[model samples]
Target: MKVLIITGGNIDDDFASSFLKKNHYDEIIAVDGGLAFADRSDLSITYLVGDFDTIDRTILEKYIHRPDICVHQFIPEKDYTDTDIAVKLALSLIKNHHSEENEEKVIHILGGTGSRLDHVLANLQMLKNILDEDVRGIIIDRNNIIEMIRGERVLKREEMTGTYVSLIPVTMELTGITLSGFKYPLENASSHFGESLMVSNELLEEEGRIFIKEGMAWMIISKD
Candidate 1:
């Protein structure tokens, strides 16, 4: 089943509301202050996960009695962030509800990026932990969709929605990288940290692909 988790970040109300309306997922989970967005947008939130530190007690109290909502509150001193907890919960649910024959589970995180650089970086790094799992997670912001990658895979470019596709090496080096259907194609190119080797690359056709033979990379697809 498809799950969408909306967190509390810098989100444009109109855009977030519209996107939430368009995507009809199996479950919708709201994290902390994200509950306020869902309340304002009139969206039905299935689950609420977070520390409840940033949320207004009065507003949160209203939902406490709701039967459809499952609240998981954590201590502020915990090591993992609210988003991290939400991700783990989603993965657990997916594992319990679905079997091996089913399709791969998808977990989309909204409100993942904003002013807090530490939180943003932590969310980005969290993707790496789930890369090898059956669950697929992405951090979606107003302008970009970020995901972690390991081993070999193909990245297809979408038209208009995202103008630029870039790859940042998370480790020391990413080997045997091949780029196809892109303006600046690369075959077995070695990418390293502190390098602008893979930035502003555009799709030459309808789609573009990136193949990583080894190591890990963070793929950032952003709007112009």
Candidate 2:
């Protein structure tokens, strides 16, 4: 199942709405102020999760009364952030409805960046916790799409889109890294956090692949 989780960050309504219409998503979950964005986009938000801190009380009351939407409210002084709760809820829903054998559980997180740099960094690190899980997820913003990769994976580049692809070493001193069909290709390269080896690399062809022999890495594909 394809689940789209919209967070409370700055969102491009036009791009997000257009993307949703083009893709067939099984569910749409909005986090906090994201509900307002979803409403403006004319999208049906199935689940709303967050603390009511930033949301307008009047608007929330109207939506809460509606039977179609399932609203989950948290305390203002809660431990977890709204985005964290939304992701956990989505995982639970996916686990309940989808079979264990299904391999297409995709979680697309929108509005995950922009404001609150701490939250953004936390959300990025959250990917590490779920790296070993069955679900595949990515945090999407206007400029970049961030995802965590374990083992070996191929990343195919598209023309005029994702102009640059960068790989940041998270841990384990990423080894056996190889990049094909890119401006700067590597073969069994090892890098640390401060290394400038995997930044601002462009796609030479229509496709490329990134592989790690030992550890995991955070892949940041961006359009400038």
Candidate 3:
């Protein structure tokens, strides 16, 4: 199942509407202040998680007693952030309902980035954990779609979300990096920390290939 987590971050209404209409989601989750956006958008939520600290009380009242929605409330001074809790819940739900025969599970996070640099970085770290569980996790905002990958992946032209595709090393070092069907191709290249070797690349063909032999990197598909 593909689950979507909406966190308490800056989300543009026009962007969110456009994004929602373009993609299909199996489950929707609202985290704390995200509940306000979910309510405003009239999205059918499967799970509501947060401490109700930043969310509007009127919006919280609307879904608290809904039988179809599962609410997971936490204390304001809890150890984990509301977004973290929501991600864990998504993973749990995916595990409980997933089957060997089912297609790959994916978690798409919206409202995950904003002015707060610390929160944005923390949310980015969650993608690595999701990768460890054999699931795909992506963080999406108005300008970018971020994902972490370790092995190899293909980027289809039609599925590209933005005009620019950039790769930033998540690990201290990355080796055996190869790129094909891109404007800037690389063969068995190596990149280290504080390097901008692979940034702002574009696909030259119908599809682009990226293979990383060691270490992880963030594939950011972005727009101006």
Candidate 4:
């Protein structure tokens, strides 16, 4: 099942609307300010959640009484972000809607990658929370699509969504990391934290592969 979560951020409305229209989502969530963005995207929110702090009062009032939307309100003193709670809801839905063997539940987060670095980072870290439950989390923006891959990942050049594929180290060190069909190929390469040698890579052939024996890697696909 594909669950789409929208969070408070300075998102590109046109890009977001286009993305929402193109993809089919099984579940849609609005996290506070995302309620306004969801309204702009012409999408009906299945679950509206958050502390209701950052969203517009008028927008909140408009949807607060809607019968179609399931609203989950929280206090401002809560520890978890709206996106975090939304992820939890999506996971719960997966458990009820899918079979026990359904481990491929994907959560695509939109409108959460904005100028606020702290919030953006927090949203990205939410992927770890999702992964812990054996689910996939992807953060999407106008210029970038980000995901964390701990094991091996295979890709086809033509299947890529952006102009560049960058791998960032999230752990202390990653060993036995091999890159094939890349402009700058590596064989059994090892990297420590804060390494830039693996960034901005392009595929040389039709197929590409990233083999990681240990540690975590965050892959960022970005356009020029």
Candidate 5:
């Protein structure tokens, strides 16, 4: 199942609306202020989650009255952020709806990165949880698409998200890293925190491969 989560962060309406037009989502979720985006775009969402803080009262009431949508309301003082709760909920729904006939499960998060550095970092850290669940989670904005991975992954030039691919360690150290089909390739190299050695690499061939023997890392495909 492919799930889309819209959260309360900076979202370029043009990019986001265009994305929706080109993609098919099995489910769409609106989190707190994210409901505003859904309302503005006239998008259909299956689930609504968050505290009633950021959204307008009339809008919140309209969605709450919708019988087709499941509303999950939390207090503003809750320990976990609304996005965290939404992620857990998305995973649970995916598991329940999963079947032998279903394709790979994925969660795409929009409006996840913005002016709030703290929130952006926290959301990045949450990708690890999604990885642990064996569900692919992607944090995306207008300029960047981010994901966390361990082991190996392949990137196709045709399917490249942006102009550059950057690898940043999620752990203190990532060991035995290898890169192929890249502008700057590496073999059995180790990268540590606060290092920019693997940044801004480009694909040199039709397909690019990344292999990590130990530790997880963030793969950011970005544009200027």
Candidate 6:
């Protein structure tokens, strides 16, 4: 299914509402404070998952009585973040369920980045976990769209929404990296931690392509 996971993190109403309106989602899972965002944005949530720790009791009670919304409440002291649990559940649902459109299962994350740097990093790391399920996970904020990429990929310039595109090694050493259609293109370059060798690159023409022989990269496409 084409599922959108909303996490209890930093969310801008204008951005979230616009994005939610633009996408075609079969289901929207609200995690904790995400419920508030969803309510404020006037978006209907298919499932609600979290400890209810951050949500208002009155709002939670109202949703509890709604037959249309499936609620899963977890304990406050769990090891996994509410976002993590929601993602795993979404993966399972995607694997077992079919989508209206015959395409790959994908998850778009909303309200996942901001103030909490640790949560932001954890959410970024979760992108790989989501992708491992053969489901594409992308974190969309007002400034950027972050995606975890594996193997060879082509990003058409016209398909890009941001002004700058950066590639960061997700592995210890992402080797044999090649870039085309970018102002500062690279060929057979290797990037490792301790250095952001690949960042702030712009597309030179109608398309930008990336070829990775081994390992993975976190591709950040930003507007500002």
lDDT, candidate 2, 1-224, per-residue tens: 88899888878877776667767777899888887787777777788899978877776776776799898998989999999898888888887784656458878999888879998988898777556666787888778878988676666654334678888888858788888878999988888766778988988877787778877778888887
Query: Model 3, 1-224: lDDT tens per residue?
Result: 78999999999989998899887878899999998889889999989999989998888999989999999998899998899998899898888984568588999999999988999999999999899888999999889999999899999999997999999999999999999999999999999778999999999999999999999999999999
Clashing pairs in 4: none
> Between the candidate structures 1 and 5, which one is better when assessed by lDDT?
5
Ranking of predictions according to lDDT: 5, 3, 6, 4, 1, 2
Q: How much lDDT does each candidate structure score?
A: 0.82, 0.81, 0.92, 0.86, 0.93, 0.87
Q: Return the clash pairs for model 3, or none.
A: none
Count of residue pairs whose backbone atoms collide, per candidate: 0, 0, 0, 0, 0, 0
Scanning candidate 5 in windows of ten residues, the lowest lDDT window is 97-106
TM-score of 3: 0.96
* Candidate 2 residue pairs that clash: none
> What are the models' TM-scores?
0.92, 0.93, 0.96, 0.93, 0.97, 0.95
- Measured by lDDT, the strongest candidate is 5
Leading candidate by TM-score: 5
- Can you write out model 4's per-residue Cα lDDT over 1-224, one digit (the tens) per residue? 88999888877887877777778888899999988888766787789999999898988998888999999999999888888899899989876784546446888998778878998888877787787777778999899989888878888976787889899988889999999988988899999789997999988889999998988888898997
Worst 10 residues of 3 by lDDT: 95-104
Residue-wise C-alpha lDDT for candidate 6, range 1-224, written one tens digit per residue:
68999888888888777777778888889999888888877778889999999898877786867899988888999999999999888888888895566586789999889888998999999999987887789999889999999888788976888899999888898888999988998999888865688899999989788998988889999986
Over the stretch 1-224, how does candidate 5's per-residue lDDT look in tens digits?
Answer: 88999999999999999878877988899999999999999999999999979989888888987999999999899999999999999999888984566488899999999888999999999999999988899998999999999999999998886999999999999999999999999999999888898899999999999999999999999998
Worst 10-residue lDDT window for candidate 6 reads: 97-106
In model 4, which regions exceed 4 Å deviation?
99-103
RMSD of 2: 1.8
lDDT of 1 at 164: 83
